[model samples]
Structure formats: structure tokens, C-alpha cells
Target: MTRPWTVRLAAGLVAATAVLTGCSEKQEANETLPTNGAAETTPELPPLGPEDFPVPAEAREMTPEGAVAFVRYYVGLTKFVAENSLDPEPLLQLSQDCRTCIRIAQSLDEDRAANRRYTEYAYEFTGYGPAMLDGETAQMGFLYVQGPITVVDQAGKVVTDRSAPTPVELQSGAVLLWKPEQATWVITGLTVG
Candidate 1:
């Protein structure tokens, strides 16, 4: 039989990928600003709701609630990676030995190699479901979210815009394991399907 930690790792990776892969949502709003002689227009970020994931202030506190919060925070990070193909240093510190995390990092490399960039990237969580709690680790099962992603070339022209009318429902079956000594939650695995 596989070790319990091994099982947890698998679950974590699966869930993480599900969330990470679906990280392409854009909120388009044009705002007008007064310039020297005329009005200038700029795009505004998407509106945020409670369901949206916010980066946590303290990740090391151990609790079921903390695990859930961490997972929520992770969703935001996933969206950042998908849109920009860039890995945030703060998130990298939390995720150690996480395959999805590595894949995200690699995607940035691929984009650079191909001379492409992504923009108007965003994600939204429809639901933050209850987590399956063990002792130190927790599995956040099947949280649904949706968004769009747009790719651009080095010349600043639009390449591919993977946008859809319906929000892509990601049954984010992500698993997170907490570390008391480190005061953080490590993503052991993510099930993308």
C-alpha cells in the first residue's frame, strides 16, 4: 500500500493543477481619465468578491481554517502564473516539491523561449468548499472557479484569446499539507482532472 503521505501528495497535486490550469479570466472595464488636452482610457482590474482568493498574511498558523485560507490564497497565485507565466517568489517559498508549481515555472520558461507573453489574465472562485481535515494536512476538494486567458506576441499583438462565455468550472481537487515547524502549508500534489 502506498504511504499516507504519498497519497496526500497525489491528491494535492491533482487539486492544484485543476485550479492552476483554469487560470484564465479577464475583467474588462474601460475608465476615462482627463489628460493634458483630452481624455485617456485605461483598463481596470476585475472586481473582487469574498469568494476571490487573497494572499494570506500569515501562512504558518495551523488550523483547518488556515488550510482553507492557504488554499484560497494558492488559487490567486495560480491565476498569476497562468496569466503572466511568472512565478511569485512568495508562493515558491510555500510550495516545495510540488509538481504543479514546477510546471507553472516551466510554462514561463516556455513562453520566454517562444517569445510570447500573456495579458488580461484572471480567475474567480465560484465556491470555497469544506476541506477534508486530517491531523496536520487538509484536502480541499472540488472548489469551482472560472476565468479567461489571452496571449500576446513580443510585438504586442494579440495571439490567442482563450475566452468563453461560460466560466470554466474547475473542480479544483487540491490537497494541502501543513508544516508546523515551518509554519506553512506545502502543496504535495494536484489532480488536474
Candidate 2:
């Protein structure tokens, strides 16, 4: 006296439905319970602007380490913009009257507008010199190596290629001003080679 396969499947389905319904009802009951006025509310974060990037706590301090951290963050942000083909507004926002910074941003923007993108542009910070702190300004020397760059258009046509065998090494300096109001540093002068 064996039951048909369809009948067994129907019975199994009914049992599963009953179990699922019971679990769902228990879940609903738990969700309806009050928290005794101790509910936690998470504060909403402010909206990010075109130029906004998260500044680490270390970079916000007005110390030598902070200056180094800020420069590292700036270089990382620039790389991020180039890699993602994003607008260079974030880089521009961190500079005051830095001509080199402005030129870099403008070049990035022009390439973006022209549908040209870098394929293999990379930077490595080799070392950082001691930071010289003035009243509200800090200056530092940095050494970095830049890998050969290759830019291509949307149609895969090479726009600019500097694919040398050896990476180019550069020694550059930066002068940054601390803005207490914003609790951050801004590049006032920059020299890149």
C-alpha cells in the first residue's frame, strides 16, 4: 500500500508551507515588539560633492606626519581620478593657487572630454624629505617614479604614448597651507618634474 509520487510531493509541499508560515508569523511577531524607547538612530552622512573625497584623520592634523599623509592622499586621489576616468575636481579642490596642480587637473579634464583615457599610468612615492613647517605653511620634498603612460581614444587609437623601457624618476616639492576652518591642508605651491 504505497502512495503515488504526486500525492507524496503534494503532502511534502503542504508540510513545507505550514513550517514556512509558522516561521514567518514568529518573525512578524518579533518585529512588532517595542524597544522600550531605546531605539538607536543612525545619523545620516552629508552628501558628497564633485570635489569631495574622504580625508583620513591622520591627514587632518597640523603636524609633519599629517603633511606627509595629506600629500600621499592627494597623490592617491589623482591616481584614482586617472584610473577611473573621473573629473579632476577633487584634485582642484585640494589646491589653492598651485599652477602645476591646476595644469594637471586641466590636462585630465581635457583628456576626459576628448574620450581619451590612460591605459598604464602609475606612480610610486619613493621617499619623503623632512617637512618644514612655517606659521601656517608646510613644505616638503618628495621623490617618485612614474611608469610610462599610454593614452588611447574611444576608438582604440593611440593618442599619446610614452612607453619607454625604464620608468622616469622625478623629484618634486610642495608647499601646503593649513586651513584651520576646514581642518585640512591645501596645496599653495607645487613643482613636479
Best TM-score among the predictions, by candidate number: 2
lDDT per residue, candidate 2, 1-193, as tens digits? 6669989899999999999998878443465766778878854433222434576767777998888888878877777787778988888888998999999899889889988877877778744755788888999989867776677888977674423235788898889999887788888888777
Pull out the clashing pairs in model 2.
Answer: none
Model 2: residues with Cα > 4 Å off, grouped in runs? 1-53, 161-165
lDDT of each: 0.62, 0.78
Writing each residue's lDDT as its tens digit, candidate 1 over 71-190 gives 666766766655655534445656767787677657666675667776666566533555677887777765555645666777987665433334576666667887656566777766
Model 2 scores worst on lDDT over the 10 consecutive residues at 43-52
The Cα RMSD of model 1 versus the native structure comes to 29.2
- Cα RMSD of all models vs. native, in order, equals 29.2, 13.9
